[model samples]
Target: MSTIIHASAAPKFPLPFSHAVRAGDLVYVAGQVGVDPQTLEPIGGIKEQTEQCIRNIEVILQEAGLTLDHIVKVTTHLARVEDQPEYNEVYAQMIKQPYPARITVFSGLGPYLIEMEVLAYAPSIRGE
Candidate 1:
């Protein structure tokens, strides 16, 4: 059975989807943008946006009783290829050693400069 997860620390945009889904030992976090929690507005340049995206993902993980260290995989999308260097810098700083396997793509991402989704795992605690 799977359970939906939502983070109160993140923006509530009245979207139709849950922020993440937990199934057994794994949690699938949906793609997150750089929208500010207070204003619900997309943040500044790539660096700032990338930071916010990670922060948003962190909140989702928190709701699942997990942390960044639990992430096993990641998928990143970049609206502009030119911002790759800045994105990489921010990403590296946010996620520590023994990094999760990741795939990054440069594509049009609407109004956001960067976005990321993650898969994390932890031992099942439903019965305990």
Candidate 2:
């Protein structure tokens, strides 16, 4: 059976959706914007927003009893294609070696520069 998950420390979503949903061994995290958890406002520029996006995903993963290492796939949307270089720099630093499969594309994100979503593989890590 699938289970819904929510991260109390993650930013409250403006849209209606759970932070994540776990189906058996996989957890699918909803897309996360580069917004502060407390303020729910978009952070700085591309690099900074990228960092925050990963951080936000981290929180949701943590709630699932998983870590970044558990991520198997990622999908990101960038408001500007030119911001990719800076975004990659931050991503390379935050995400470790043997990185997850990822796809990033330039898309209109309204006021935010970056948004990300992830899928993680965790086999009964929480004894669930």
Candidate 3:
């Protein structure tokens, strides 16, 4: 069976989408931007946006009773390829050893400098 997970800390955009959805042991996080959940505005520049995006992902993971350590893969989309190094600096600090498989994609999907999505896997929880 599949379950949908929503993060209370995520901004309510009145959009028809869940923050992340879980199926069995896997969780797929939607694309995350730099917007602050409360304000719904882009956080900062490329670096700050990258940081915020990661932080947002972490929050969603926590809501699912998971952690960054449980993430199996990450897909990043950038507005400009030139910002990769800056994005990497912040990305490296978020995950630890045996890092998750990741791919950096260049696209114009969001208004911020960085956008990210994640996939996580873990044992079933009590209410999951």
**Steric collisions counted per model:** 0, 0, 0
Residue 43's C-alpha lDDT in candidate 1? 94
Clashing pairs in 3: none
lDDT against the true structure, each candidate: 0.89, 0.91, 0.85
Query: Candidate 1 on 1-128: residue-level lDDT in tens?
Result: 99999899977777788899999989999989998987889999999999999999999899889988888899999999899999999989999877889999988888999889999987732222
Lowest summed lDDT window (length 10), candidate 2: 119-128
Better of 2 and 3 by lDDT: 2
The deviation in Å at residue 23 for candidate 2 is: 0.2
What TM-scores do the predictions have? 0.92, 0.94, 0.91
Kindly report the root-mean-square deviation of model 1 from the true structure over all alpha carbons: 3.8
Task: Please say which candidate is ahead in lDDT: 1 or 2.
Answer: 2
Residue range 1-128, candidate 2, lDDT tens digits: 99999899999867889999999999999999999899989998998899999999999999989998888889999999899999999999999878889999889889999999999999632222
TM-score of 1: 0.92
lDDT (Cα) of model 3: 0.85
Q: Model 2, residue 99: what's the lDDT?
A: 81
Question: C-alpha displacement of 41 in model 3, angstroms?
Answer: 0.4
Return the clash pairs for model 2, or none. none
Q: How many backbone clashes does candidate 3 have?
A: 0
